[model samples]
Target: MGTAALVTGASSGIGRATACRLAAHGATVALLARQAEALEQVCREIRSAGGDAFVVCADLVDAVGAEQAVAQVIDRAGRLDMLINCAGAAHLSSFADDAPSQWQCMIDTNLSGTLNVSHAALSYLAAAARSDRGTADLVTVGFTAGRQSGPVTSVYAATKQAITAWSEGLRRELAPSGVRVGLIQPGLVDTPLARRLGAGPGQGLNAAVVADAIVYVVTRPAGVAVAELVVRAVGR
Candidate 1:
């Protein structure tokens, strides 16, 4: 079977760059996100570059939708060797300042969304791990905010922190299964999310730079597990 990978939030930013990078490395990539038109555009770009890609448009915040999206990827891609969880939301606000809706948005998208997709893809990833590939990767796109909290981004930071802890536990749990679960903790990237949070050029890493970190994580030889990588801009 050919190597197949699934990437969430592939419509833009780090997710988009990761999907393209994985495809350029010859993995059949399934791009997942809530944006149909945007995902289709990504798919077109991948195909034009002689890479195989397909779009799976589903809201990751909904458990059922996330499961269906994973199923769709397996159905079309034949197998899933890598699952990259990049579907997340970032809302910078004080805990007391946010309305209930805003807090829920961060919790549901950043925290629960990542869980739902990872849970749905676990068995498939494990099965792939047992295949001739002999290894599988389950990656979460985390942030430095997860390691150190910011005052205004209380809720957002909490969500990232949760994912970091969850990824660690998952790494231990899936270790024997030959599934290498890892997290990419980047300091600041020039993603749509970071721009919305006021990150200026030359102040943070580029989205593709983080994507390169992800590619590095997934491409290590078998039995070599990079549990977590901290990517930060120079002199920061």
Candidate 2:
């Protein structure tokens, strides 16, 4: 079977870049995100570049919707070879001043969202490992904040920690099934989330850098698993 990859948060930033990278590598990519217009634009970009892609606009926090979205990707692509969880939310502020709403938003979008989609795609990924590719991949984008929690990153750090923890467990559980589960920790990426933190347009590593790291992780030989990676800009 040909390669088929589903990338969450594909509307912008790292997600969008990753989807395009996977598509360019000959994977039939399914771009999943909450924004229909942005996703359609990415879809058009991919098709115009002679790459295969489709859009699946759905909130990953919604379990049923996530399941249906995964189904749509598989139905459209015929199989699922890779799943990249790049959808995320960040509320950067001191814990003393952070609101519950911010906390909830980060948890829902970062942790729960990844869980919902990975849970939905587990079986299909396992099956894909048995296909001609001989392996399947699950990748979650994490952050360095998860390791060094600072004053303004308390809650965001917690969610990323949870993601890495969950991904580690999943790696162990899926290893026997020929499924490679991995995590990417990108430090100071110049994304929408970073712009919210007041980063300039060209500051930090571009989203495409992390996208390249993701492609490297997923494209390794079946017997070699790149379980964890940390990508930082040259001067970062």
Candidate 3:
């Protein structure tokens, strides 16, 4: 009977941390990811801590999988109060050096997956807004790579830039209906995805930092929407 949150990419990194954090604070969490075993483990941890959690194995890159994941959460949870579109892929290759398939994978998973889950959860979130469930919110993870052009992360940055623009537009459009849209842009987090970036001499941050920012945005009192929060390492 607590609030329900649907988190994509909930098996590891920031997604897993966010799921545990939210559930710890009394939200029923739905964990979505392609790795069934990992997702189950997170759900088990949450449940063991006396929190509510459900696991849904999904590849957010696929449209069908994205829709089905959200649908299943709604079917079981009865409603969805928050959606964390945390599903994405990380690639580190120069534009010219990168294969076309690599670029496509980044786009599909980072940009397309965000849209797919948000679109699927729209109705349920809107309904939560209409009722007394509190302000419905959508939070998407972004990166500083997308804000500036980089030598190696060109396409990855592009996908994140798309997310920033799209989320802003969504924030304005949904504000009137009591649904808030938020974006968390973190600079170089020490996640599996971040390691894939091959930071070389630079050290970013741990994924928990990003998870804390998300908790701040979603847990704030109703009527106050934290539209966007950007966190970066001090040396970065």
Span of ten consecutive residues with least summed lDDT in model 1: 194-203
| lDDT at 15, model 1 | 96
Q: Rank the candidates by TM-score, best first.
A: 2, 1, 3
Mind sharing the TM-score for model 1? 0.97
What is the Å distance of residue 91 in model 2 from its true position?
Answer: 1.1
Per-residue alpha-carbon lDDT of candidate 3 for residues 1-236, written as tens digits (9 for 90 to 100) = 37999998899888999899999889999999899999999999999999999999888777888889888998899899999988889878888889999999999999998898889888889888888866888999998775786888889999999999999999999998889899998888777776666654336777777888999999888899998888988967
lDDT of all predictions: 0.92, 0.93, 0.88
Q: Regarding lDDT, does 2 or 3 come out ahead?
A: 2
Off by over 4 Å in 3: 199-202
Model 2 TM-score on a 0 to 1 scale: 0.98
lDDT of 1 by residue, 165-200 (tens): 999999999999999999999887888888887877
Best candidate according to TM-score: 2
lDDT against true structure, model 2: 0.93
How far off is model 1, as Cα RMSD? 1.2
Off by over 4 Å in 2: none
Model 1: clashing residue pairs?
Answer: none
